[model samples]
Target: MAEGGTTLEFTPTWVVAVVCSVIVIISLAVERLLHFAGKYLKKKDQKPLFEALQKIKEELMLLGFISLLLTVFQERINKICISENWLRNFMPCKKPSDDKDEGTTAHFQTFFSPPVLPATVGRRLLSEDSSAPTYCSIKGKVPLLSTTALHHLHIFIFVLAVVHVTFCALTILFGSIKIRQWKHWEDSAAQKNYNAEDVLQKKFTHVRDHDFIRNRFHGFGKSVAVLGWGHSFFKQFFGSVTKSDYITLRLGFVMTHCRGNPKFNFHKYMMRALEADFKKVVGISWYLWLFVVIFLLLNVAGWHTYFWIAFIPFTLLLAVGTKLEHIITQLAQEVAEKHVAVEGDLVVQPSDEHFWFNRPKLILFLIHIILFQNSFELAFFFWILVQYGFDSCIMGQVRYIIPRLVIGAFVQFLCSYSTLPLYAIVTQMGSSFKKAIFDQHIQEGLVGWARQAKKNKGLRKAANGNSAGSPPGAAAVQMTKVREEDALLRSQAKGTEIVTDQRSNSSS
Candidate 1:
């Protein structure tokens, strides 16, 4: 056993921090130095400086991969867990017992309870029980992972990965070389902007019938396809329907097959609708997907604490994507403008040709990115609360955290990835459901308040000396109207008297 093997330590955390910091510092320094050298070498050939930077980039990538391997497998390397029985003695007991000195549930509670660090640390060391038989060998206490079958399995997997990566690199190299050698390729080949349009169109378009049905065998459609088959097999139970019916149709059918239960599957429906809306209205810009993968990987690795650190990479990707998208869009517009300019009257709108949708994709893309990013942070916080127990924190409640997190995740998935059909369903359900969910009195009060607001607005306008005929002060400006009415009345009376005189003269 090593002399300092059982010492209290937080070495693993410190080592990871130091290694990462050193790697980052070295990489940045090299990149800056190369960039400065490139500026100086403008008079000289620029090829060497560019090559050096490229080599540095590749080296940095290898260094990062090695650092990651070390961080992940550090525990496997150290025999500390096996050698340190002193640390395990303080860990939570597997079960409760009657003995006071022996560790129990009570001991776990006492150790992890409120103000834990103060209460648990710096306890006087107790002597080991001499009456118990001691095991001299380490094998019984610590399982040897080197001899285990799992170690061989890990080695085999990594070997296969190395082969796969090497093959991919060779394929890319040969493909690039061949492309460069092709004669007049740039002049004869279809415009690069043409491919950009195809990409945007495919992203924005709904999945076609053939793709949707065929996709059932893929991981995504397994549940949906199975449900569709069950619905077809038991169509009579659900109620007899024509072959054309949407929900009961099988996997090969043109219609969308219903997957979840109709009553409780509002969230699923919402998600599908939301996805469709997102695709059509604000197509994904491609680069956001890369960041999403990065986020998921970090979360799985339990490195979610540094999730914010991803913002640096994400922002860079976003800026680059935006610039690329802008260039592609401008190129398309320029092509259109050139054709129109030849016609002498045709006008070309860049925006109309640039994006597939009326709204910008960036807005929706950012929204989803933000939501995905926050989910990891929230999941980590909940995990901590669950692992440490409720009494661990001053404001922690007795409720289970895991179940809450699961429900939260379910809701978050529905909210972010799908449209909320429940909102529309509730809206269509009308005033009764609204009254049940919200108070009828509150609704009435809101209505009354709205009416009063209109009245107040009119009064305010009148007080401000507005003389528009429709305003509240219109009655105050009716003196001329009243005078005109009186004059007309007197004229009618005079005409009646003249008609009477004419009738008497005719009778005589």
Candidate 2:
């Protein structure tokens, strides 16, 4: 008990370390089990089973958070001592010591007292000799943070680890749900054009091969839509901007007002759209800011934050990775629409340049990777120095460059792992884009609103007129034309009847 009626007790670091280790091991086991179950369900074609598991995992995560909060309250008053003499002077202002032991030095106070470093042990070594200097002889040491704040830090780290894994699982589960919806649409669309009979085979074979490619990239599109990450990009390129008045009204009204050849420059529009979307690609990453705060708190109290900082950026990188996937997807759609004519095989024959690296595209890829991955690493690099005052960890190893280097390497590694397909897809797009640009057909085959609407309107009017009116001619000529069409229809019917008779006779 303190002189001012406050209680102080030492909670062992080894105990906190043990608890953290147990939580980490359990969390990993749970994650691996969930992953195993997910793969099993997927293999067995049990979507409902996987979905039910997702629901259970979500429920468990909630309970875990509740239990974590309860645990925090149970131990909120006890602070764990992790570091000594580090950041002691930088702690917030406190009242001066008024006791007989006022001049006690930090090294003596830390080593001589109960809150000794982790390696120190035994009363024989710690006990002071009567001739030697003691706690009373040295100045008092400042704390890095309030005792209460340190108590809360332990709970924060544990909860952060559990919650991070849970949220990642939730992301994967959401992706799985989207995959089901895509398959349903693909199968339904394909079923419409399927026929077993030969007579109508040509007429019923309406499904395009590129439809498979389109369905596969549906996740890429859905992710962008759900995250609102690249909606504006789609709006500009696809000529589908709803809220932009210049796009919706001015250009549209002018195109409608003049029914002639396009006065609007499609080439300029594509260039501007690309430029606009480029600006929005790497917008502010809010998760980086949250990480900075977490890291600062962890350093102040010497608490083990358990690399939860990397977790947010990992998730963010996944989201950005999903967005980058559009490079492959958009190019596939373009190829399907143009060269394939929405009917042929959905494949791009890559140019010689595509097999070897193109420096410009490589630079763009690096820019995106660095912006998404290294931005967080650099933030933590400087912030660690700010909190610790020294450029080293507790073990006296210089850490200024280690985290940045190690994290950057891991990020680069993950980028390669997560985006291998993305790289190949981007290469395909680059090849296609190069050909399109060389041929001066960058905007070729792009659907336009005004022209297509007019063409559709004309088709509808012609259909209505044909059903409502007689063929335009003298009555005799019109009758003669009708007689010719009747004769042609009779001949086709006769030919079909003869073929049916031949088939019946052969079978008999």
Best by TM-score: 2
lDDT of 2: 0.38
Candidate 2 ranges beyond 4 A from true positions? 1-139, 143-150, 189-294, 297-322, 328-508
lDDT of 1 at 193: 30
Listed per candidate, the RMSD to the true structure in angstroms reads 26.7, 24.5
Candidate 1 residue-wise lDDT at 253: 13
Using all chains and alpha carbons, the TM-scores for the candidates as numbered come to: 0.20, 0.29
lDDT of 1 by residue, 1-508 (tens): 2222232353477777898999999978977986787667544543333343444445446545755674466345423234434323422222233344433233233221111222333221221112322232334443222112222223323332233233223322342333233223222321223222232243332222223222221222458445544433333222222211112112111111211211112222222233333222122224543654454333221133233442442443333233322322233234332342221111112232233343334433544443333343343343334433344331123343444444444433333212122112211111111112112233345565456556655655554554554554564555445445546645655554455335323321
55-170 per-residue lDDT for model 2 (tens digits): 55664666577556645543332223224446343322111242333222221223112242222122222122323333423434433333223433433333443443333333
**Residue 306 deviation, candidate 1, in Å?**
16
Lowest lDDT 10-residue stretch of candidate 1: 246-255
